[model samples]
Target: MHTGDLAVMRKDAYIEIVGRIKDVIIRGGENIYPREIEEFLYAHPKIAEVQVVGVPHERYREKVLAGVIPRDQADPLTLEELRAFCEGRLAHYEIPSRLRILASFPMTVSGRVRKIELREEPARER
Candidate 1:
């Protein structure tokens, strides 16, 4: 049973699924889970939806990239603003370094987000 899910066992034998192994981002030797970051970003009032992915980095192995769909298209979110929101909340290394405002994410026929498409897009640096 190889479900790609990464989980942890608690003292009570309860299983907690943190994220998927394929989506883990290794930045500067740090393991960053995109699912955790996505959960945190959902707290933002302006963000309607978000997908986090890793992009190649020259120095670090990879960097976090967030593709967001804002609740209000007229008022777009900024990288600095997102950083400010994440500051102190999430680990500094886990914060998204790049941001892409997308109207809608690429989805499969099953209605699942196609993160592979997002990873293929050119990352925009702030």
Candidate 2:
């Protein structure tokens, strides 16, 4: 289905997706919604698609991470910009601490974005 179709489906459901079942980030005291950050990133004109995941965090138990696909080839949106956009739209704890840009998302044969696969990818070694 098209992006518009997916958007409509999500809207009709009245719930924002929070990554796959295993990817939720539980910070020191709150449950963060990664899809909230992803939706905020979609508001940017240059972004084509976005995904958010939870990765290990030394202080908070887990931190939010964003994976983005930009529409423009020359200048991808910066992590700072994505963070600022999300910060403006979401609770401070929901903002992503790490951001990655990809040319396209990995999808299933049926054209569904496979969030589980994204969540399984190894995080940056710190």
Candidate 3:
């Protein structure tokens, strides 16, 4: 697929989709896998779900922004809190510099989170 997908072929000739290739954030030339960061944060008690996206940055061209849904609505982690949590566990580049405490992710009828719509949120709000 030309839509930036990572896939694998099995011995039985089945094509299995892995992850979205375009979701990779190139920050200061470091490859930051959003899924890895998302999974890492899932282990934290405060985080219920997270979606990492790349936003424009003058220095790195792109930086990480995490859309977090808290386990407890009243206890959403601050950007600094999340940074502290990821400090030694994840590489510095993989840590999110910004956060959006979302009520819920925009989803398609097919049940997939619509990252395309998520990406356009800033523009839409203007």
Candidate scoring better on TM-score of 1 and 2: 1
Off by over 4 Å in 3: 1-4, 7-18, 122-126
Predicted structure with the largest lDDT when compared to the true one? 1
Candidate 1 Cα RMSD after full superposition onto the native fold (Å): 1.9
* TM-scores vs. true structure, each candidate: 0.93, 0.72, 0.81
Better of 2 and 3 by lDDT: 3
Clashing pairs in 2: none
Per-residue accuracy of model 2 over 1-126 as CA lDDT, tens digit each: 333211213646775434443445798779766665677778888788888877777789877777788898789988788776766578888887777788887899999777666655745456
Question: Order of all candidates by lDDT, from best down to worst?
Answer: 1, 3, 2
* Over 4 Å off, model 1: 123-126
TM-score winner: 1
Each model's lDDT: 0.93, 0.72, 0.83
The TM-score, computed over Cα atoms with residue i paired to residue i, of candidate 3 is: 0.81
Error of 1 at 24 (Å): 0.6
> Which pairs of residues collide in model 3?
none
